[model samples]
Target: MICFMKNNLIVSIQLPLLILFFCSCSLLNADEGKEFISIFDGKTLKGWRKAPKTSYEPWSVNDGVIRGEGKENRLVYLVYSEDENLKNFELKFRYKMVTKGNTGVEVRTRIDKTGKRPFEGYHADLGHVGIGPGVLGAWDFHFGSGTRKEFPCQRGTRLVIDSEGNGKHSPIKDAINITEIKKRDWNDCCIVAKGNFFQLWINDKLSSEFTDHISEGRLESGFIGLQLHDKGMVVKFKDLFLKKL
Candidate 1:
């Protein structure tokens, strides 16, 4: 009878420890699976470079945030210079647009001195559009020298871009929830690019996606940049992270 009682006590003790061990192992595996690298230190722009004509006063690091304020006559970009080129990767960051203006992130783009726009590449657009703020999450292609300078795909669109820089968009039944995006508040933005596939997520909701089949005009690889569009605008970005697949 004493042995039976002792065995019961041991089993009760071992069961919780075993359960905890398994839970810890599962958590360790999950953390190991996600190999995200921090691109921004949140205190300084150590691995970033601004466009030639851009002023430093408008771009400053304040309280662990990359803050952009004031005005510029033209668009300017703070390009990531630490990495050579990003081809197949997932980039994520938190951004807040305080002013009623435009801001975006450029991917697979390069600096074009002759181009009219600040960055010549693909842009994940954020901010207001038209009379309403419906087009906060969208995608745009800014070709440096093409006849079609800009090609846009709106939120909840599954688009296809051809080699001639022409785009065809189809509505994605129920992908986006616009109400989830907090205007003038900190929002999450994620971009995934793999080969010809590209996707954008805002506030953990799928906003837009596209496939590029443009053999001649498609960009395979280029630098990543943060854009400040229009004058008298303020935008803050933080928690910039990237994972290469």
Candidate 2:
């Protein structure tokens, strides 16, 4: 009887330890739903480096948000603090469109020495209508490159959308429509990536889920980037968050 009780006590002690260990791991991986680990310091671009500007201009920040206004040529940017990749992770932030040109988030991309651009692995697209969540016809360069044509990103969708296309979104659906997107107002953006499965959301609305065919090379890890096209419009970003899965 004594041996039985002792064995039970031992199990009780070890079981709690095991439970605690697993709980810690779970808490570590809980992405978007948990408190965000700040990527931007909100004061300065301390850990960020600007990409090469085509016109030798600079991107400025306002009231804790960073922005780029292109009056010259297109400027591409990729910033990183350490040598790490952002593969299969959830990223959430708030962005506002002032004047539309060409803007989208780039992920799993490598920065080029030219500083003028970065190669895209995958992108959560916004910049069109009839896209974002599950509206249908979501596309990307990797998957629907030559196959899915009719649907493409057209200026107006403000909804966050999930898509694949060499990190540039295509065949948009459920994305925040440009009309619904408040001009000069702050809006929310969210993205989730797992293996080839990707999901995007804007302003808390489920945008879309996509499967990629090209596979952005399945980079072990890469820097996150914001892009601006030649048209020259103002795009503001703030409240950047990232979590590892």
Best by TM-score: 1
What's each prediction's clash count? 1, 30
Tell me the spans in candidate 1 whose CA falls farther than 4 Å from its real position: 1-34, 128-135, 147-149, 162-166
Cα-based lDDT at residue 218, candidate 2: 42
Off by over 4 Å in 2: 1-35, 111-117, 128-180, 213-220
**Best candidate, lDDT-wise?**
1
Question: lDDT per residue, candidate 2, 33-65, as tens digits?
Answer: 554467786667777766654555446667888
lDDT of 2 at 123: 57
Query: What's the TM-score of each model vs. the native?
Result: 0.80, 0.62
Query: Which 10 consecutive positions of candidate 1 have the poorest summed lDDT?
Result: 21-30
